[model samples]
Target: ASRRDAAPTGDFHLPGWLDVPSMAVSRSTSRLRGPGPANVSTSGWTSTMHSLRVGILLGCLAFLCGTAGAGTPLLLAGSTVLYQRVLTQPGAAARATPGTAGGRLITALSRLYVYEREDLAGQAWLRVGTDAAGRNLLGWVPARDTLAWNQQLTLALTNPAGRERLILFRDWDALRSVLDAASPPAAGRALVQGIAAGGTDRRAVALEPETYVNLYERFYLLPILEIKDYSTAAGNPVRAVKVASVTLPEARGRTAPGSALADQGSAAEQLQSFKAAIVFVVDSSLSMGPYIDETRVAITHFYERIRTAGLLDKVAFGLVAFRAESANEATNEQLEYVAQVFAAPTQVLNGEDFLTRIAGLREAPVATDYFDEDPYAGVLAALEQPDWKDRFDARHIVLITDAGALDGTVNAPAGTVPVNNRAVPAVDSSTGLNAAAVQREAQRAGVALAVMHLQTPAARQAGNLARATAQYKDLARNAMTQQEAYFPIADGTRDRLRAALDTYAGDVIAQIERSTRGAATPFGPAARAPAEAPADAADDADQRARIQAIVASLGHAMQLAYLGERRQTAAPEVFEAWISDTDLADPGLRTVEVRVLMTRDQLSDLRDLVAQVIDTAQTDLDGANSTAAFYDRLASIAATFERDPEATGRRRAPELAQRDLLLDYLAGLPYKSDVLDLKKSDWTSWGLQRQADFVDRLRKKVLLYSRYYADTFGWVDIAQTDNPRNREAVYPIPLKDLP
Candidate 1:
């Protein structure tokens, strides 16, 4: 280090990587010592004094060398702004110029947008800045000290409590080799253990399992820079993706100078303080009197248990009653209310208060025109009426109904959007929400819906049971749990309904107990591994197990949320490392899930584009006798709709299939579209039925887009601009929901 700092005095040689020429060093040294003493006494003492002065100068140079890349500036190789971005590694410094010193110190895993690239003696250096536009220059950083991140695609890690700790390998081959082993799981365990024990192959592991936490409910994102697809030795497909772990800005600014949870209280105290809000949305027509009476009994008993456990403040209940609406105003009046909010969760201070508030709740005197009722309206009310985010971490709505939800029926006026199938105005419900819309709204509010469907004799006779089951399952589906939390009571017996409610309530209470005892982990003392039921297990056992699993999932989510808010748990800052999407312990379970970051404008554009395709297909396909005529009509329509009709001709695929017709946000996504890639030839090859199927798929996509656009809860203003129009405000949409 001392010799390198001397600036080539008396045949000093620099490292080849530094690429400093001898003449350049000489000129630099000469410039530094301008107009010094010309003559001096040639004595031993003078020589020693000169040597001491040189030593001081070299020491000062070494101090200056602390600035990374303090040498000749490398020539710029290119100036095009790179679409790809990068994250920094530890000790990475952005110098003022390529191979020159003194610039900003970037944090590990901090995102940087590159403006230019330069190579000096086989070392690549990137000129980066603060933003994608390259407006604010941050300076140059060596390519070796950064990780390439192109798509901005990120994965949210599932809870690691039940699963083995994710092993981040140094490269793809290391991960693949483990998966290819005769016993992949055993090999994976051995590799992890070897790394943990500091064996010879320790360098193969970039991060230990314990360094990462379950990012179930936090802003932390693990950006996937690269992805590899491969099959295991057993022919099971697996994906190994390279990810750059980051602790985002949102994770900062919590309690300072200590563990955030420690600042509040002890770990046990913080975990025990988990709160839950459960709202019962009931179908209360004339025939529901007995069920309503039983519901009251179940709640009263559950309240007693909660009070006994001293968790009165931790749990609260609200009620909503929904009935059917008809085209006739008189029918609606007779029904009294489509969805009446008896009590909001906020209004219930205690168990006594909850009961008192809903004392007047009862079944309506009149019945509806059909077996299907406005259950979605009741759910919408539950979601909209309460401040779920501020009040509770575990928010749930238990929908108790005997009949199916009102999706579509013959009795109605025309032109209303059909939910399941066939449009009708009256069935649109008072809230103007469909099943899909209701589910999106619930997600926005972070509320889970659990349906208790009583498949009554009447429902079976009317053939509404099947439709009700499908609709209720869709409504109650929990993404984290990967299953619907819908419970079907085949006999619709009051006693059975009461028993289901008891079990649901008891499971929730058990979760709260486990959480409070610092047993939120999968193998914690309070958490027992579920006993596998026999193949011929009773419906009751199945229902009980399902309820337990759903409640446990909900509890896990709540704990994660609590930890995120209270503890500020963050992902490990690994610059670049390879990790498998599936868990090592159980290959069937996913360790990470994909999400697409979309802006409101982009979603709206996608919705509009899909709607246009639907309109065009509906208008043109009906009149056209052949596929050729349909193609001609589609081309004409595209010319009429697009701003530059001539540009439409240049499109790779005609009309609806044109990529240019979609938003820029949709264009770069790592997904293939059924409609966007269609050519005239492809459409001609597809028979009439297949073509019609394509149109139908677009319509479904349009419906999904509408639901995604309507989701108000998920949009996050990352830029903090306060302006809604700013494109920086994005929502991390689940990839499955993408059209």
Candidate 2:
């Protein structure tokens, strides 16, 4: 007889939390047991009563399953279920029986629950369905045809428009064989070519080259089912992950591949009229006159070049000037303004107007209290004050500064000066935005902030060059491009600065011209160094190389975004097979970026958790008589914080304790979190200053979370008609953005 879909054999139900619609696979594997007490006698009246109850419940479940639609869950017998979750292999077929005489094809990478297991000879078969709830059933299939996925980890392919096509291998040995070849790149190329040519040897490859997908274009799940970590013969580490592509319900009805917006035009034709804007955010301090003049000359030369190329109207330029800020109103009056926008991005299309606006720009008359200037003010102005979105598709802000930014930290070593040295009290930027916060806003605005740091001798002597370099690099970092648009001048000469600016501007123009002509400019592969070379030096050669690479990447990213938005270019709609997370030829280049699917409630909880930690630490540290006592208090507080929510008053549970979803997910993930797994010993090991720095970093992260919550456009609504804060609506937050 065919097995019936029914509920568990007794009056049993999952906990309230587990009553959620989604079935999350448990990370741990434990032995299954039947319902009722283990020691109950089978022949007793109590046992007979239990058996009768089980039978009645099973009968009711059978009636319900028969009456329900296809999407309803089939609650299987809990005792017989082997695994909580499984994913179908590519081209996997399910049959009515254990043998594959006749079968129906199932969706590859579909999440399923194992209902029953059968073993015959040496092979095993599993009865699987859509979820533990028994929503959709697919009959018995060979064990090898499915993969057990405990963790819900997924990988989304990075944009492949400007890079080589990503390859998927049948197995690890096939991938390793290519890596061990005489010339790995050449061998990989040959393999891809052979696969394209078509023959029996094509079986070595997992999927066709054109099927790789990005999460942004199509919101799908490519779950990482299994992973193998090993070192190559050359001692380089490599990670080989087994991935199964799952197209979510939302991806249905999208325009098929190769036919996106065919009626409008090709992606390139649509991009021919794409607009770009570049703004020069110059520091107007006393020492920046020469640099300011150089900036003007560079823009003048650039405008003439673009005009000659018949692209003057397509590209626009603007300028913003920033000076020092002070707490005293009189001192602020002397400084004139914290930051002033001299020209809107779209205001200056002609060379004459742009030159006229820039020609009168001058340095501040009086020197401020500290060497570090309020560059954040200028960046915010450049980002906020302009109609960048309405006028331009590709927006950029080139910050030309000799000094570091005024950091908000109380005693930060790099961008901060002593409180006593100031003639007037130093004030934060007018917008009250720090570097990281400014970068987030820039990201929200879809504008890239590039920094041209002039490493002058005075800056180096003031011990600000190194600090400023680090700060500027972070400020200019782009998450999409995964590169920093930071160009540092070793000599800090006007000629060098002008040349760098020219090269940077010229590269962008060239990219636009090439992209407009239907040609894609591929960024050069990263340059590898010998084992003895310094790891990450800010050398002039390296900086120039980075500038070129970042410019190219940014240009490519901008073009891709435009095309995706215009053409409605969705990701490929197909179940995928195994694909490598990293590039097969270049293991160092990751083809996939992992992101955490977070919700509004989770972010709010995170903020509250950090705030609570900060408050407890501050209060405990101040009242404790000794460091040991402080640690003791912190340990006790940590215990209280993670304590069971029910143990605490139901109305007043700790915010962190209430964050079950995020906490459980993070615990399962392999990455270490300082906040989640913080220990008393960890706190005790830190010196007083380091401890304070830790608190300060957490405080900043809290502030950033507020900005993220307010960014209404960044979050997506998976359920379009549902409330904005509904659980279905989520933001795929970059892992790096996590506190």
Candidate 3:
């Protein structure tokens, strides 16, 4: 039943599992009374009722057994489902049912009949069996939390990384068809993920306490790159897990991904989507022969591997080949640099079209008198090309050059070698953008820029080579959101260089995933399909997207703030995942794709999440990762605020006052909001500024109240600041007395 074709697709319908006879007792296993209820005289009426009940019970059991497999054992779930248990022994420290950090579970048992039992703490305990490594094993489980003679069926899928993906279902026929069609991974197992019925909207699989003995809440994932998204609607949720473990041809390009929520479409469309603009920008000097050929081959290999994995729908390719202009060409200015577009960026994933386009690149028709080519010109041309898509899901630019940008400040590389005065500028050149402008444009356009220096053997010994590497490396960092974005792939060999390119092919997917993942839902990239917003919902959807984008932006900012305060120098994604999936340690975070914009209730929840993150950062600062410094900074700020003389005398900040008013409203104290005073026509009229003004007005109420009772008349103590803390005393202060 692990196959999708084997999964149930229709509405869940049980075949009379609970239908049982209710006959009067003819006999009893214990006590003096017979099988019927005690004190029943065997009268004609009683006999007739018994016959009907017996017949009904028999028919019910027969229906149930028909649906169930023959001789199948079953166990009753204990009172406490998702109860903690150790795989080792009864007294061992408990672990999650799925168990943290292990290979895929081969099989899950539906139920175990208790041949024997022990009573412990008013709960029935029974034994369950599991087979592993060719041996039968028995584990202890609490009995009777859930009771059903029928088995709870599940589909357990695993990725090549041994990460288990399981989905529980009452019935799903679609899943079975998907599984049957999928070709498994080269190494580990592969399984499909599906929507089921559960606490969450989708992720419908229900976890059985007896199966895991580890948890009641269930979570599952499907291999992202391997599976096809079954649904194509604008809002369908597609569950996915990172496929970083899957091997691909090496790549060296840098990747910068945009927000998952900002993507053009819903989760399913986004996952099925690929729109990227990658301009190779290769230096086409005579010395670049082997460099260009090998780079193209490496990329070809990468495409082949991804094609095998069914991920071509997620990528596009472009090319730019350049050469230094001859002395006769200097009249054309930038044209003297001789940079030209080899292939405009387009979706290569649709077919084998990219291979032919890339094969067309060759050495320039003429050679240059100078060592440096107009590398900057080549890069600028790539960014200016019109072939790139406007509404890209992700975008990247790969810069490949062998020589240094022309630097006017430094005398022509040891002279007499005929200085390439058409030097790349530190910033934008008079004719074109320098590294800074290129990077700034990339960042603004959400295009990641990667600089791959195809170095010659002499690159290390020359001062010019060092300068070029330094300049390009800084360019890479500027184009990316991460500090260690450059890959020093020691491109001294063909294999090493190919490996670097392969890194980009894989890392691009990874970086995109990190940037787009939501903070409070299933921890995968969240995106909307590229379809136009419906006319009826255009404004509502747009505003919703804006609010979510803001929340996600703040989430990113909070993580950065924590790292900055702590003086840490690590990739930001580390903390992002921590905040998004906080409960992964206890029970796994619910695996549901949350792509919709937050509603009013969800907005409140997002606020709560913000508060939790802030509070957690303040408390858990003593670890070795320099979180202690972050905590200390927070404490220092708090102390400073507390020590403020103005604060002591109730001269509170407007923001603080506003927060107090909002908190009160959230706590269910809905006084006629002063915010509604300047009533707007509708929510569309209430932009962010209006929302801010509302909070400020509400805050003014708090401040005015504070000044009257505490500062002006001394009606209440300063310590009793927030409203309702001392309601009776506050009321006695009088509306007339209030300032």
Q: Which run of 10 residues does model 2 get worst, by summed lDDT? A: 37-46
* Candidate 2 structure lDDT: 0.56
* Tens digits of per-residue lDDT for model 3, 246-283: 00111100111242322343323333333333467788
Clashes of each: 1, 6, 55
Superior candidate under TM-score, 1 versus 2: 1
**C-alpha TM-score for every candidate:** 0.69, 0.68, 0.33
**lDDT tens digits, residues 1-739, model 2?**
0001111233333221111111111111221111110000000000101111000011212211222234432322231111234556545678888876658776554556566666656676767664434544667877766665544345656544334445566556766776666666667667665554543343253332232233433455556645667665556566767655444334432333334434665556767877788888999889998888888878888889888988876787888988876656676666777677777767776778887766657897778767888888778767765356666778888999999887654424433432232212223444444677667667656677898888888988888887788788788875445556777776588877877787778888886776567764332232332212123434546555656767766766666556555544333323323455665566645677665544455555555655665677666444322154444432332332232111222223343234432233233243323454666577777655456555555566665555554443445443311232211344555544454
lDDT of each: 0.56, 0.56, 0.32
Candidate 2 wrong stretches, greater than 4 Å: 1-154, 161-163, 168-218, 248-271, 356-361, 385-387, 410-446, 516-546, 565-567, 574-576, 620-668, 674-683, 720-727
